[model samples]
Target: MTPTGDELLAMLSALANPLRLRIVAQLAGGRDYVSHLAREIGISRPLLHMHLQRLEAAGLIVGSLELSDDGKAMKYYEVVDFDLHLTASALAEAVRTLPPTDQEKP
Candidate 1:
């Protein structure tokens, strides 16, 4: 189902963090195990899992349990959709809410 304006805003807010953004970017490449993501993104496993949970709550990503060749259970995460087309109004709203940069600060 398509998300509403409020849902989009909440999702965007969840993604506004730098670490979460990086995690999303990495997931965009392909599905990856949580541990692998933590290693690749240079964050702690617990912290990565926390961010993953937030992303999942936003409905931006999904996770599933998988078994490795060595018989270990792993959680893999992937972007829910490769094509996320935001409405023009939503895009405008997002742009308007961006934080001011150092140069733009009063």
Candidate 2:
């Protein structure tokens, strides 16, 4: 689905951070639980969660809660299969469908 301008902006903003980009790259390899993902990325779980929430809010990634073998609930995250086609024409089309932003209002 073609994202609306606001959605596009959200996705881009979410990925603008280096840590967030790294998080996406790591998840691109495979789905992983929060604890393992935090460890692999060498960041604290709380910080990882902050980035994860941003990705999730942008629809770039999704998280699901599941029970581990020991009956512990774990949150697993994976990247969403989204294709962003950015070009002059695409941007124009997206802008055409965009709702006016605060700055755009007189």
Estimated TM-score for each candidate: 0.75, 0.92
lDDT of 2 by residue, 9-51 (tens): 8999999999999999999999999999999999999999999
Compute the lDDT for candidate 1. 0.86
- For candidate 1, the per-residue lDDT at 52 reads 94
| Predicted structure with the largest TM-score when compared to the true one | 2
Please list the C-alpha lDDT of all candidates, in the order they appear.
Answer: 0.86, 0.94
Using lDDT as the measure, which candidate wins? 2
lDDT of 1 by residue, 1-106 (tens): 4455566667878889999999999999999998889999999999998999999998889999988899999999999883557788757765656666799999
TM-score of model number 2:
0.92
**Which runs of model 2 end up more than 4 angstroms from their true locations?**
101-106
